[model samples]
Target: MDIEDLHSWPDSVEEAEALQERLRDRVREEPGPAVVRTVAGLDVAYGSHSDEAVAAAVVVLDAATLRVVESAVAVERPSFPYVPGLFAFRELPALLSALRKLRATPDLLVCDGHGRAHFRRFGLACHLGLLTGLPAVGVGKTFLVGEHVEPGRERGSFTDLVHEGEVVGRTLRTQTGVKPVYVSVGHRVDLDTATRHVLALSPSYRLPETTRQSDRLSRAALRERESDPASAPPPAAAPRGR
Candidate 1:
């Protein structure tokens, strides 16, 4: 779970955006692992009282059984500002810390955010995949940037999400009669493979099991940090842009 030191932490919005543009070229839009035995879900939960407090969680699950195999959590204050397109800068540090604590190296990473579907096409998933050198997919709860037709009511149905006339992702229906989730290529995963993985992971819920489980764990960790103030880490210095 060692992450590559890709670049220094950006100090401003301009620096972050420039970094994204540079790293976007490194993203490989290819098929992911054919046999995924373990998949890790990544998510972050924020404190209700303080905007700075946050918890990042990584839950590795058995791909076939959909049960957690290993889990880790990191609680820290966000250093980057909350800009719309630069959220990865805010969450990546804590998420990477959590990932480093995991004993099991996941075959695939399912992030609770956008990938190629973002305005810059280098969302959290892409950033994470590049740093970790792991195949990753982005499953967003809401649309970030795209125009797409509504998918069919049946599960597995999907429509192309077009952005700037390019097929960036898919509006996938993971469950029958449920609001579709957005599936985008993170790093080495193609759109089709990403869609199939997402559908398989979400057997009975609108969101994938990876996302659901990680979400719950992140919230629980945040609650733990809130209840015991002494456990909270010192606040990160606010990035210059903020």
Candidate 2:
């Protein structure tokens, strides 16, 4: 997948916001896949035994069985400062590098963050999907910027996450008698499809397997980097070629 952005790494909040504004319109809210064979999950882990480094992990799974197919991990320094809504800028570089390491082109991208449910309507999932031209969905653990009524305790129940009077995402109950996860359309995907994918992915746990696997992978990568000196970030990542 080719990631297209006029500004790949923005230093300031104004520059990042401007780049996000430029790319936000490219997102498509369409039904992604009626039957998905493979889905990829992405997450980042910070504090890798050093404040300057972070680890990114991408895990691809067989959607039917929810079994891991492939996984990749990349460690890199934070390219941008920590900003609330512009998280993609901080993590996307490493995530993209890790993404390129995958042998499988996933049918859908299940990211551990928000998508359209953001202040700029462009979150990590949206940025990645727009760049890769893939059907991506954001599965956030916590609410970012939205107001929603509490969903039912039963699994599969949901409430509209309204932000600025617009339906940005969904507060979805993926497991019975558990806290709901937030679902949002990333790119080339809709709310209903995103919600359905989330439910399908999370069978027993509060978080989906994609998230769990990737999280574990990232932390492991960080630990490996801590013991090994050869794990430093390269001057150039193949930048994670497809």
Alpha-carbon lDDT of model 2: 0.86
Worst 10 residues of 1 by lDDT: 233-242
Encode model 2's per-residue lDDT on 25-136: one tens digit a residue.
9889987578899999999998634347779999999998999999998888876778899888778878988887777688999999999999999998998897788899
Please write out the lDDT profile of model 1 over residues 5-37, one tens digit for every residue. 778788999999999999999999887588999
Candidates in order have lDDT scores of 0.90, 0.86
lDDT of 1: 0.90
Question: Model 2 segments beyond 4 Å from truth?
Answer: 5-8, 48-51, 234-242
